[model samples]
Target: MNCLIIDDEPLAIDIIAAHCAHHSDIKVIDTCCMAMEAFQALHQYEIDLIFLDINMPVVSGLNFLKSLKEPPAVILTTAYPDYALEGYELNVVDYLLKPISLERFNMAIDKVRQRLALPKPAVADTASVRNLSAAQSGPVKNFIFIKSNGKLVKLDFSDIHYIEGMKDYLKIYTHDKVHVIHQTMKNMEEQLPESLFRRVHKSYIIALNAIKQIDGNCIETEKGGVPLSSTYRDALLKTIEK
Candidate 1:
C-alpha cells in the first residue's frame, strides 16, 4: 500500500515513516509538513494510507483529515488525549500516542490495513466444511516460531503458560523464557487453536493445560499471573465447574 505522512516535525515523520519503510508491503511516497504540501501530492498520486498528526501549525491535523472529500485510511498520531474522542467520532482507524515503539506502530498499521482490506466472507460448500472439520479433529501440533530481536525461538504450546499484550507486542510467557513478538492480541488468538489456548481478556490468552489456578480476574500459571476480563470469567468457571 502507498502511504503518505502529514506531520510537522521532522523527527516524528522519520520515526513513523522509517518503520513503514521496513515493511515491504508499504511504500511511503511522500512526507509533508503541512496540509498544502500533501494536497499537491494527492493531486498527482494515489495514497492508500495517511499517518496524520493532530498538532500542527496554522491548520490542525484533525481538521485537515475531516475536510477531505474522500479520505484514505487515517491513523491519528499524537501525544494528547483531548482529541481522541473527536478523532474516533470521525471514524479514525487507530489512535497512537507519542514515544511510539516500532512494535506498536506495526500493530496499528496492520490493523488499519486489515480494516481497509476486509476480505469478503467465503461462500462455504457443505462438502468443504465437512472435510475441514474432519481434518481439524486431529491433534494438530501446537507451536509458534517467534522471531524476537534477532533470534528465532521455537515455543512448544504446552510450555506457554500465558501471553500478555503490551503496547504494540505480546509477551509470550513460557516455562523457560519470555519471547516478545510484534503482533496484536487478536492476531495471536487466531493462530492459537481453541484446544490449546483461550482468550481470557481483551489483552490475554492462556493455554488451558498450563493454568495453575484462577483468582477473580487473574490467572496463575507456571510462568506468572495474567488478568482476564469479566466477560470471560464465566467461560473459565465452566471448565472448573465440574
Candidate 2:
C-alpha cells in the first residue's frame, strides 16, 4: 500500500519510514510536517494508508481527517494515549503511541492489511457468507486471538460478555478483564458465529449466551446493559425467537 507519514517531528517521521521499509508491500510515498502539506499530498497521490500525528501546526490531523470525503486508512501516531478513543471514533486503522516499537508498528500495519483485504459492503456477499458459515459449523472456535500490548493474546469466546466498537478497534469485555484490539466492527462481527453472537448496535456485538435479559432497547449481560439499536433490534429479537 502507498503510505504517507504526517508528523512535525523529523525523528518520528524517520522512525515510521524505517518501519515501513521492512515491509515490501508498503511504500512511503511522501512525508509531511504539517496537515496542509499532508492534505495536498492526499490530493496528489492515491494514498492507501497514513501514519498521522494528532497535533500539528495550522490544521490538526483529526481535523484534516474530518475534511476528507473518502479518507484512506489512517493509523494515529501520538505520544498521548488519551486520544485513542477519539482516534478510533474517526475510523482510523489503529492508534500507535509515540516512540513506537517495530513490533507495535508491525501490528498496526497488519490491521491495515486486514482492512484492505475486506471487500466493500456492496460486494462483500460471497466472503461474508463463507466466513459466517465457517464460524458457525467449522469446529466451534472456543477461542480467538487478539493483538494486545504488542503481542497476540488468546481469549476464550465464551468468556466474552460483549464487544464495543471504538471505530477501528474493539473493546472486548470478559468476566475478569477488558481486552482492546485493533480491528473493525464489521470484520469482528463476521468472524463471530451468528449462533452465539448478535450485532445489537452499530457499535456493539454481544455474546447471546451471556445475555441475561432484554429490557426495552437494551440487553442485560452479567457485565452490564448494552444498547440495542433500532436498526438491529428486530433482527436480534428474531434470532432469539428462533
Q: What shift in Å separates residue 221 of candidate 2 from its native position after superposition?
A: 64
lDDT scores of the candidates, listed in order = 0.75, 0.80
Show the lowest summed lDDT stretch of 10 residues, model 2. Answer: 118-127
What is the clash count for each candidate, in the order shown?
A: 0, 0
What ranges in model 2 sit over 4 Å off?
A: 118-242
Error of 2 at 6 (Å): 0.4
Tens-place lDDT digits, model 1, residues 1-242: 77898988654664665456445466677889998888888887899888999998888988898789898899999978789999988888888887566678878877876888844334446455334433433445556666588565667787888889986688988887788876567546645667678888888888898878888777887777778799888887786564
RMSD versus native structure for model 2: 13.5
Clash pairs (backbone) in predicted model 2: none
Evaluated at residue 68, the lDDT of candidate 2 is: 86
Candidate 2, residues 1-242: lDDT per residue as tens digits?
Answer: 88899998664664576566556567678899998898889989999999999988899889988898899999999878988888989999999986677678878888887899932223235555444344433455566666677675777778889999997778999999998876667656645667788999999999989889999988998899999899998898898888
Total colliding residue pairs, candidate 2 = 0
